[model samples]
Target: MTAAPVRLTARALLLDMDGTLVNSDAVVERCFSRWAERNGLDPAEVLAVAHGRQGHATMALLLPDRPAELNLADNERILAEERADTEGVVPVPGAAAFLASLTGLPHALVTSADLPLARIRMTAAGLPMPSVLVTAESVGASKPDPEGFLKGAADLGFAPADCLAFEDSGAGIAAAKAAGVRVVGVGPRALPHHPDAHADTLTTVTVTAAPDGLLTVTVG
Candidate 1:
């Protein structure tokens, strides 16, 4: 027999960008691959830790001895490259419909992308930008630090425990969980993180808002 769908209730929703709503792996791979080769690091390994964290943070992890300032500068260049190269960026399956379902609901985009990068990717993906956003510049710390997710919950006027986060990376899931928000794992990348609910894609998830201001999210 098929298992019953998992249902989660929350006052607001927090969303991660890259792997969750937008599929920008093509650009990410191309940009990071070049950066990795330049630094004499393996592209695959860099990409492995690249998603869901600020570029600077990813650089720091791969090159621990590098000065923080250099990482920051590298992050700027990487963001520029990513922003200019939206060749393969597109919305994930059901992303448009999913966002439509959240109309008039309390939700925020909590992502490691800086504002410009986030805007371009969303545009390339043909997805609407959430009115409430907690991008990289909005927080001092990156994913796995809980800063962005915490700020997202606060921006939506909901306590962390009252929010549900949708993430597609281990770092993003960790950050949400650390901020006291239950997570809905999106895509294969999020599976190992073990979110409260798992969906292969947004196609398997649906959301509805109650008159009392609660959101019911169902993941099949």
Candidate 2:
């Protein structure tokens, strides 16, 4: 017998870009690894603290002795590198279809990547550009701080509790949860974060507009 699907209704959908809506793992790792090598830091350790956080924050963590201005400049250079390298970038499974289904819905992209890098990656993945994009530059802090997600919810004119957040990283999940948003975790990386719902990929979930003006999300 088939098990019943889980359903939730939300006034808006908030999504993380890399590793959630798009797959840019290769480019991300490559750029970060190169940056680490250039800075005499361990690539593995750098990457461990990098994902889902702003570039400047990662740089600050990795090089605490450095001046904040230098970290900011390094972040800008890394963003350019990421923007220039999109060879293996692609949409997450069913991401394109899922986004297409949200035509009339309130949705936004909240990413740690700076604006230019986010644009490059999304364009490479062939994903539709979000009408509302809250990038790293738009917030005072990154994921795990809840600033971006909170800003995203506000930009969509939805209360934090009324939004549904989709994320694939622990930092992102923490951010959403802290902002009082229910989260649908996108992949294995999100497991430890204990999101409200879990899916192997976007393909396993479906969205529909309800009569009561809510977006109904169904997960299998």
Candidate 3:
């Protein structure tokens, strides 16, 4: 039997970039692999824990012995590489239309990417750049800390519980949940996080704004 659809209502929407709204998998993998090869680390292992976390944090995790300045420099190089290579960056399925439907709504883009890289990726994906963007530089701590999502909710002028988050990675899901927001996992990659609602793609979900100013989300 088919499970019944789920509905959630919130005052604001918090979204994650990268694997969530933007499809930059090619650029991400290539850069990480090249960086790993240059650093004498296993590329698979490096990527295994990299997604949904800030580049600097990923560097720190992969090379704990390295000085903080060195990690910072390497992370900058990675961001530069990503910004220069927009070969395959595009929106996730239904992301463009879904975002358009959110016009005039309270929403924010919360991402692990720093400002420049986030802007570049979003532009490449043809997404409408959000006015309120919570980047890596916006928080002292990244995902799994809930700082970014909390900031996003605050920027939207709503409490965490008044927001609904959408994410496509385990770390992003954890961050949203930790911030006290109900979250919809946006892709197969987010399934392991066991988000409140799971959709194979954004196309499987719909958003509607009510006269009462609440956003209604329906997921199949």
Candidate 4:
């Protein structure tokens, strides 16, 4: 028999933003595609590489030969636009309840999105802002590098092995695994490059509703 996906015995959860907790795929794709077109690059290539990476990191990969100042300027422009208009952005199915249930847990938002963009998206989605956010600006590297996830765990006062990660992209999964955290895949199973416990959405996660209004989430 195949072994059950590993679920860590931890008190903290590191949640990813985009596809994991929020359904911002459309907005992200539209924005990035426009950016790519303006830069004379393919939209597909930009989408593929930028899905779970910081904007600056994506710029570095997309325009590796460009000066850092140029990349920064572009990223800043993107952030301003995103923050100003995130109309279609919303939390993933059941994400609001899941996050509400995790009110007392030692969890934090660990996302590749930079601070301003992340906040704008979260606010637009009406999701409670996490106090301990490890944003793109907080890390030297983005997802697929493990730095973001690791930093989140550290900031939460837990080891990576003692944290559970909720991710939706291949890059995010790899980052969580690299950080030694057990992962629960929360979107298209085909997107993840690594093996992990799969769930159709946040609703699929088995959460026990406690009498005191707390939820004990279980990932299988």
For model 4 the TM-score comes to: 0.87
TM-score of each: 0.98, 0.94, 0.96, 0.87
Q: Which lDDT tens digits does candidate 4 get at residues 1-220?
A: 8445433346678999988887888877887888999999999999987877767778898898999898878888877776776868988888898888777668899998888888888888899888899998898877789999999999998888878888888888889999898888888832456545677677767554446533355654
lDDT scores in order = 0.94, 0.91, 0.90, 0.80
In candidate 3, what are the lDDT values of residues 1-220, reduced to their tens digit? 9878899999999999988899888988999999999999899998887889888888988788899999889888998898899999989998998899888988999999989899899889999988888998899997878999999999889999999999988888988999898999988779998899988888878899989898999988
| Model 4: residue 147 alpha-carbon error in angstroms | 1.5
Off by over 4 Å in 4: 1-8, 189-191, 208-216
**Residue 112 displacement (Å), model 3:** 1.0
Pick by lDDT: which candidate is best? 1
Give the Cα error of residue 55 in candidate 2, in Å.
Answer: 0.8
Off by over 4 Å in 2: 1-4
- Candidate 2 — what's its lDDT? 0.91
lDDT of 1 by residue, 42-144 (tens): 9999999999999999999999999999999999999989888999899999999999999899999999999999999999999999999999889999999
- TM-score order, best first, reads 1, 3, 2, 4
lDDT score for residue 73 of model 1: 96
Global lDDT of model 3? 0.90
Runs of candidate 3 exceeding 4 Å displacement: none
Model 1 weakest 10-residue run by lDDT: 206-215
